[model samples]
Target: MKFLGSLYRFSSSWVGTICIVLFIILFVAQAFVIPSGSMRVTLLEGDFLFVKKFSYGIPTPHIPFIEVPVAPDSDGDGHLFQGKRPQRGDIVVFRYPKDEKIHYVKRNFAVGGDEVIFDLDNFYLRPNEGDEFIEQNYDKSDIVILNGQKYVKEPYKFKGINYNPHFRNAMRASMLGNLERKSLAMRPIMVAESEKVYEYGSVKFNAFYIKVPQDEFFMIGDNRNNSGDSRYWGTVPYRLIVGKPWFTYFSIDPDKKIRWERIGRFIDTLQSDESLIYEQK
Candidate 1:
């Protein structure tokens, strides 16, 4: 009877210790999860990734057993740890600016002092000189086909207001049924421009001409037309960058089949040319 009591006490102590260690790791070391497909191709819908917390420094410590209402400082302003500056093309996970409780992930595109512009399906990055846009091609196959014909789908620039041909067609088809000739003649007028624009696909507008301040980054998803990124919410502050994803630990399809081939895949750096991988495949 004495031996049994001793064994139970030992087990209880070990379990408590394990729980405390796990809490610390999750709080200060790493966090793992299956993120939304907002970063598809680069990060899949059901893919699991590990986010390193310490790559950047830790924030100000709140009083033990009591949550502090003040904003935590990750910069060296007076914090215990000072984070490194984020670089372009680095995949980072951070607290959403609109709602700090929500977490988001995106690839860094531009840093502070950079000017950005989008014209005719291209992205331009300008620092001091005029806008230098980069051409991006969206695969037409990703578009939904209707009636066995190539619908002139319009790629959406932002949300709420339909900018692409596909959205107009969908709205027309839904309202008038089968897109009649009469309905096509009365198509809605497209606004020339607006004072402020949503990031890409959402209806929220904060400001225009995002003059990225020091220690700030502009992030976007690889899936341009389908992603809600810096184009939507504004730039993310550098202190929010959790860390770069290192590897794909697990992947599973909705059908319950484990994706064995993707289990050990290494996440490519932002500067890595995606064309090379596509070519190899």
Candidate 2:
């Protein structure tokens, strides 16, 4: 009885409180806010969410603002405890490769060893056949037989994925682009590791065929044409993966309007049911 009392007193002290909070933030959950439209129609801008850090693995905790590692990665993969890697079609949060200091969130479009081909806005994915699930359940319309192999289209099957073709590459000419070149008005371009030849939209564009490197993943935004993702920045290494968005504790609109329906909602719950999130007005 005396030992239990002492232990309780220690846990309630400031040092113990700090350790407990830090452990939750580092290993269990971390807060992340959506700052861009890249994941729009699924995860909107201003959605304040918590990332379940352990969804992938328990990574070495960094001192929050400074981003300095608190300890060395014993597993050599930045994770303190080895866990499952992000699977296809999961919304992943990770440190951006070009700038490890910054965090980025994007859907896992393709994982290591997969081949991705794109012509303008349309996509063709040739997943590594090693994943039997892809060979078994991938949509029929998207699959094409070529030289005794099969390829899938818009391969990521996340229901909220925006495949609306009418949304044009006009953004490269307007707000999204800062350059003053003719290519700005042309179709979207993806400079993949490998190149395929194709033309679209009278722009005579060269297609991109990327082979995702081992231990890396190719990320794409659900808002396809509008996002600057793997097409521009390249694939993400597993070492940089942080976690998956767990829930939206709070959400707001550009005009500071409170989104009542979205408050305290889980991302997976919203994704599973389409009819709930649309504006009632």
Candidate 3:
């Protein structure tokens, strides 16, 4: 009772309440609003969600809005605590690799030592020794045994992953090259360093094969066709990862109609729709 009373009294005070809220936002959980349509159908433009800050680790506390650093990085890894790093299939909320102040939410498609290939308008991933997992879990049709290695097609079975039907069964050009990241992935002339390239017949042309370096992750949006993801940008360092989104506390459409069904729904729950389940075979 005494501890409770003390906490209550502290929180009732202006400075104490502000500090408590800052502590929650910094170390525990933080409210994040979806600001773009990149993750549409799964997380919408107006969806309101809370980021589980401790999901990865406790980042260096920053003052709200102003974003001024409040403390020194203890481990020199941008986190106060080192926790589990991101893995494949995790929906990650992260600082934009290009701009740390900007936050972005994308599905972690590939992690370190993984080879990601975007070819022929299809997404293919060669996990580091991923063949064993594919052989065990994926349908044979979805697993392509190519050049004595295994590749999985669209391993993430999220229903929100939408592709125009016409875009499928189509030949697409692909180009990828070295990542020159200083503070972030530096972008110059993309074609200058592209050694591996393929030509295809279509206005829709995208090609590249890049290896996710150690301590980096590849992110892609659920709205594949409309999103600007690692395809256009570059891989994200684990230090840049902030947390995982927990749930939708509120959601509204462009017209401002409340999406009653989405309120209080878990992100994983929204993704686990049976209709979204994919065998691809």
User: Top model by lDDT, which number?
Assistant: 2
For model 2, how does the per-residue alpha-carbon lDDT over 152-229 read when each residue is reduced to its tens digit? 777765566774444455532331242233322123443443255444435433555578899889888887767778
Candidate with better lDDT, 2 vs 3: 2
- Is 2 or 3 the stronger prediction by TM-score? 2
- Model 3 TM-score, 2 decimals: 0.81
Provide the overall lDDT of each model, using Cα atoms, as 2-decimal numbers: 0.51, 0.75, 0.74
Model 2, position 147, has a per-residue lDDT of: 30
TM-score of each: 0.57, 0.82, 0.81
What range of 10 consecutive residues in model 1 has the weakest lDDT sum? Answer: 183-192
Q: Kindly indicate the candidate among 1 and 3 with the higher TM-score.
A: 3
RMSD of each: 12.7, 5.0, 6.1
Best by TM-score: 2
Ranking by lDDT, best first?
A: 2, 3, 1
Which residue pairs in model 1 clash with each other?
Answer: 124-133, 154-164, 154-165, 154-166, 158-200, 199-231, 199-232
**Residue runs of model 1 more than 4 Å from their true location after superposition:** 1-20, 59-79, 128-209, 269-281
Tens digit of per-residue lDDT, candidate 1, span 61-160: 3332232424546443423567676665567777677765556777776788665543324344444322222112333443322223222133322222
User: What tens-digit string does per-residue lDDT give for candidate 3 at 61-143?
Assistant: 77767777799976668788888999899999998867888889999999999977665356778888676866887777777
